[model samples]
Target: MIDKRLRVVLAEDSVVLRDGMVELLGARGCEVVAATGTAPELLAAVAAHRPDVAVVDIRMPPTHTDEGIRAAVDIRARTPEVGILVFSQHVETVWASRLLADGTAGVGYLLKERVARTSEFVDALRRVADGGTALDPAVVTQLLRGGQRHKVDALTPREYEVLELMAQGHSNRSIATLFAVSERAVEKHVAAVFAKFGLRATDTDNRRVKAVLTYLAESGS
Candidate 1:
């Protein structure tokens, strides 16, 4: 169940790949409202169409180093409601951190390889468009193993488990189910995590995103 048609704007430098993506999205019932190769075009298309989601490539046109990422960040700032899914060949933890720094909801960073599996890729897009997250597990592993744990060293082992799952974009309920613990207990641990990180719990703020950002910040990822 896809309730409504998901509109998308795609940014990819490769013509072949871009065409393929358009076809794929169309087959999956997503309307490719606009597709562009350069970051500027992508941004403009997003502004014009205001699509439900934007599928961005990490490298596109000109320098191809971080143009897509820069565009993704811009889109996030300009249209918080529009989802962004970074599809990149390289797994740059720093870039992923920048994307999720503000929050993880309505955001996703998946390796380009994941697009090979049509169903999985489409599902990831849907998840992001629905104000959820879909971070690559490898991205999480890279951040954890990158050796930036001075602040995180203070967390208890159980807290570390909770944080890791959170970084993987799991909800509190999902984490509780995985640990087979009461949701209330999970809430306590999550609260403790926020306290340890010195993040204020407010109804207007997303504590989960802040907590994960703290994890990335500590790891310098």
Candidate 2:
């Protein structure tokens, strides 16, 4: 099902793990374009090669905190075509959603433990590279804490789907296609969602982005 060879950029702080991933993916039929262990390297390597996907560790470089997540965000903004598969020790739902919180071109958040399942891990890379979405089991588990009501109260099931896609910065046309509706219908739903969230302002984009960010912040997802 993979149409073309996938190019991967990997960033993990552990030398051994980074090397192992590079080898594992390469053996699995992906091209390992570059690899690094620092946040700066992640940014620079991604900028330089613009690979098809980036597999980044959640912690890296200075502080080894959210550097990989932050790098993934910046990389997403710069290289929209590149998919980012974030590897984390813990289920960082907020950051994971934030990474996917804009344009669904190619985004994934997987925990490190899953790497042993080579088939599944490579499948995730392919899905992301092919414009699909994948989230770690743990990530989804964490998101469940937000509960259905967090969005269900303010949006129709369909509109809530649109809203979550919108949270990923998907456009009206994209959301429309996802829901098998017209752009106009998507617009209407968006309007209603804005109204429900009190985000129907001239600063719609900013407010909407902030609203989702607030939701994620509050729910820790």
**Leading candidate by lDDT:** 1
The per-prediction CA RMSD against the true structure, in angstroms, equals: 6.3, 4.8
Q: Estimate, for each residue in 42-143, the C-alpha lDDT of model 2 and write its tens digit.
A: 899988988888888887878877888888888888888888888778666667666655544467777776657788889988888776666654565565
C-alpha lDDT of residue 23 in model 1? 96
| TM-score against truth, every candidate | 0.72, 0.72
Which residue pairs collide, candidate 2? Answer: 101-168, 102-168
Q: Write the per-residue lDDT of candidate 1 for residues 16-66, one digit (tens) a residue.
A: 999999998998999999989999999999999999999999887899798
User: What's model 1's lDDT at 84?
Assistant: 98
User: Ten residues in a row with the worst lDDT in model 2?
Assistant: 212-221
Runs off by more than 4 Å, candidate 2: 1-3, 114-116, 141-145, 149-170, 174-182, 190-221
Stretches of candidate 1 exceeding 4 Å from the true structure: 145-189, 195-210, 213-221
